[model samples]
Target chain A: MFLPVSASLRQFARAVTADRLAGDELAGAITAENIRAGKPPAAAKADLFREFILKWREILDANSRPRPFSSAEYVRSLGPPPSEARLVLLLNDICGLSQRDIEYVLDPLSKPFAELLKEGRAVIARQREERKALIVEDEPLIAADLKDVLENMGVTVVGLARTADQGAREALKSAPDIVLADYNLDGQKTGVDAVIAFQDSHQCPVIFITGYPDDVLKGEDVEPDFVIVKPYRPEAVQAAVAHCLDTERFFAIDADSANGDL
Target chain B: MSNEKSSAPEKRVEKLQIMVADSELAMIDDWRFENRAASRSAAIRSLIYLGLELTKSDPDAAAKLLDQLDRA
Candidate 1:
């Protein structure tokens, strides 16, 4: 199999097992078996994947021995255990498999493949819809407005702060999934400083609502991915928040993929 | 042989040069072997195609993934 295909398989295994070590062992065993079989280089990928599904229960049972860590630890770090529908989505969306390939791999489905995929997307969308944000704008009015906007979009506003110090304290109290901060705060430290501090303990997406985009962009300290210029519309904030959440999810997956050997 | 030569017109002719760190090179080599690409060049082209398609679909996610890959 190609490197991408192998990587995809590894990722799929990881998602299904929700344990890095187990996923590595499972994929390694399957790949070794395939090599021993002396399958042709052009062997069908779908067949290999189907074999993975067929062997999952046996392999998982074999590897269920006690380890240094608990499965709950792994589940907490990653998201919840993936359902079959989510597994299909991960294969097609994250693993880059074609729909036809998935259909072949998951043959004899109770429901149509399209329906399962739609359900998967809906589950993912609902998860994304529920998010938490920390707003750090010095102006009371602006901070309230930001909170209202996020709440309207179904994101829980965790905290509102007028200075970098307050923001850091709030973040320590309750870790936020995302942060929206104004460039100039009530104290000497700018939003960039506050973001850096927040990230020191917890890493999350930061959207800088700054009047001077140039200052934030040119600042050597922190380079934020999402920045809304001052006098921004509600739509702009909403769009930035949505994009940041999506990017954060992708980062989480990438980090999980890189944690262990394939 | 005649059919192969006839298809040569569609073959890639342009050249590009770039540099990568040892770790990155190792990843490329691993990818090349896994995909069974004919050469490093072929593997790199395929990677580029994949990256472009991802970027087209979700620019933010693609950019973040690229950044992670660079750090990896």
Candidate 2:
């Protein structure tokens, strides 16, 4: 109920601000402030809650300790700053904020807030799906082609890692969603080795595109998530990535569908 | 059902203990959070699975890989 939410919010407010306002005192102050601002109680509460979360996140980020996966923390972890409407959905969905509590806190805006949640979800989903990829291909022409292909698929090419070591460095720095690596890189360390090195700390899906299948097969490092034979169609690259992200059962189904169409 | 009979199958696994620097540990923790995995173990397992799945071309690829790894 609102009791838990109110208590938690007050506790967080005290922790962050180091101000101790009694429970009713804080609520009364917030209500008075909302009235002065010419905003409805519900909307004001929602806004206040969002602001509190943002402030708390900043405080948490400044500290050395690991952040908790609480409501606000989870929202902050979603890569980019979420929209107000999206925050509402996260509060409702992830935080288990009930309609009554939302009404009490967010007020009359509760119904409309719920309505706007779907649109916000689509926006956030699109942003989340804007998968960033690091291309570790040595060939300039091939790297450009890969970048174009990935961009066309709505993936952002963070950078092209020409050598295995550079690829590892870029991947560590950017923390890309996926890696597109060529088996034979420019340096002594193969693309497979580079991806393995990246995986030692950061875990991102990788798709290996290479002409020398045996080179990868013979490698001692861990294997990539998916391998596409060279001279591949652009569509094949898209399908391979989709397959990895899709449900495990759906992957075979998707492959079957692709084959059926062919 | 009795506790033993109803219990999950015992997984035969080797514990991999590695010494990582503070920075490296932070990186792993960050990766785990970003991936939305339940735990560090789950994150590592998912990563290994993804790698294995990508490299595997056939059903018996795992056995072949083990053989190759052993020989190497």
Q: Candidate 2: misplaced stretches above 4 Å?
A: A1-129, A217-221, A247-262, B1-72
Backbone clash count for every predicted candidate, in the order shown: 4, 4
Q: Lowest-scoring 10 consecutive residues by lDDT in candidate 1 chain A?
A: A66-75
Quick one: RMSD of model 2?
Answer: 23.6
User: What are the candidates' C-alpha RMSDs?
Assistant: 19.5, 23.6
For candidate 2, lDDT tens digit of each residue in A1-262? 2123343344323222212221122333344455577876455445566545544445436544433433223323222232345445434543345555554444435347656566544433333245678999999999999998777666788999888888999999998877899988765888878877777767666777877544442212365554555776675566445433321111121334222210
For all predicted structures, in order, the TM-scores are 0.40, 0.37
DockQ-based CAPRI category assigned to the predicted complex of candidate 2: incorrect
- How much lDDT does each candidate structure score? 0.62, 0.54
Query: What is the Cα-based lDDT of residue A100 in candidate 2?
Result: 59
What is candidate 1's lDDT per residue for A50-125, written digit by digit as tens? 7777666443344445222232222233322345576566566544467888877777566788888776655434
DockQ of 1: 0.02
In angstroms, give how far residue B59 of model 1 lies from its true place.
Answer: 41
